[model samples]
Target: MRVTDLTLGILTLLGGIAIYLSAMNFQAIPGQEYGAGTMPRAVAFVTGLTGLYMIVEAIMSGNRGIGFRFAEWTRSGAALARVATVLLLILGYILVSPIVGFVPTTIVVLVVAMLTLGTRLVPAVIVSVVATIVIQQSFGKLLLVPLPRSDFLSFLW
Candidate 1:
């Protein structure tokens, strides 16, 4: 865990630096001072600071009995299988969404993902459908982002 933390901290620091440098390209306007870079810069600064703190803590605290342990191939294989299942479900969503439209596709994807992750059918279907509806409404209706509409469901919206 310590090794993982250290690696993640270093990666985050590098990522933050990259974000900050990239944000520098968005030059500020004179009257309207805040540029596209402003929010990114803030995020980068915070990320960098947190990463630095983690590194310092790791160094001073002396490992804290946490370290990396590579799993056996069998365990790793199972983990990979779970990841692959999730990926396939996501890919299925992308491929099917255009045909069935966003809501139905999302519901199907979510339910499938929940089942793949070991949730039971009834709960999975209910939670998946409700979550999909909430997310669709939030991003589409409330945020004014246009979601793909099916001919069948267009009237309902």
Candidate 2:
């Protein structure tokens, strides 16, 4: 599916606004000058600016077709299924991660997403496992973020 720049810009602008609003709720650390919302607010500002630029450009170009147009690929059930599966996988990960642990949840989500995108099974599993470990190490060790751990597989962490 092809969306007009105006449509995308509007959506992006709204998303940025929502992110900014949500980030405002982040609590400030006692001795820190910059709080958790700092980075997100900055990113939201930039995203909002980018969306504004896109909207202006779209209007200036005067070639903005209907808000969105469907491409030939949209008619393919397989293509639609792939998109839907990815969305569902993300939702599943969010709901299941806390219960099953970040490592297993992320690995499963990645493997399914890769396979849905036509990656081979073995390669998908390998990449998913490797990527999950990298992410776990980066967040849990390097960044000092505590990820949920599964009681059944605590050794994995």
Candidate 3:
């Protein structure tokens, strides 16, 4: 189905409001000028304002109701197949990450996706590994966020 900007804007606005409200409950860090909730609240406010602007633009442009064109969206089988493949791959990653570890799961998903999209084997593997390393380093080292480690292979990291 084709969802209009108006509908998406409304949903975004609601989500932003909810996020902002929930983030307000977070406690400020001791002796810190900016609290832990500051970033989340700022992000929510920006999202909400952006959505509100979109809603206003949609209304001014005379687009009132949402347009739902299901048939028009599903006419191409190949397009649908690609979309489904990516979605299923994401679901697979989520389901298997804890078992195989986050790094391996991400690399597998990326390599498979690249190969399915007609990339060469060497390039696909290289790109996937590089991307995975970059992401792991960025989140784990730079951001101090912990990634899932496989029980069997936790020593590798």
Overall lDDT per candidate, in order of appearance: 0.79, 0.86, 0.85
By TM-score, how accurate is candidate 3?
A: 0.52
List ranges where model 2 is wrong by over 4 Å: 1-69
Reference-based lDDT, residue 27, model 3: 82
State how far residue 141 of model 2 sits from its true place (Å). 1.5
- TM-score against truth, every candidate: 0.54, 0.56, 0.52
List candidate 3 stretches off by more than 4 Å.
3-73, 151-156
**Model 3 lDDT tens row, 29-126:** 88876797999999999999988998999899988777555666489887788789899999998899878888889889999899778899999999
What value does the lDDT take at residue 93 in candidate 2? 85
Better of 1 and 3 by lDDT: 3
Root-mean-square deviation of each candidate, in angstroms? Answer: 6.3, 7.8, 7.4
> Global lDDT for candidate 3?
0.85
- Roughly what TM-score does model 1 have, to 2 decimal places? 0.54
lDDT per residue as tens, model 1, 15-58: 88999999998978777879788999999999998888777777
Model 1 scores worst on lDDT over the 10 consecutive residues at 65-74
Which lDDT tens digits does candidate 2 get at residues 31-129? 886788899999999988988888888888995654788999889999999989988998998899988889889888999999888899999999998
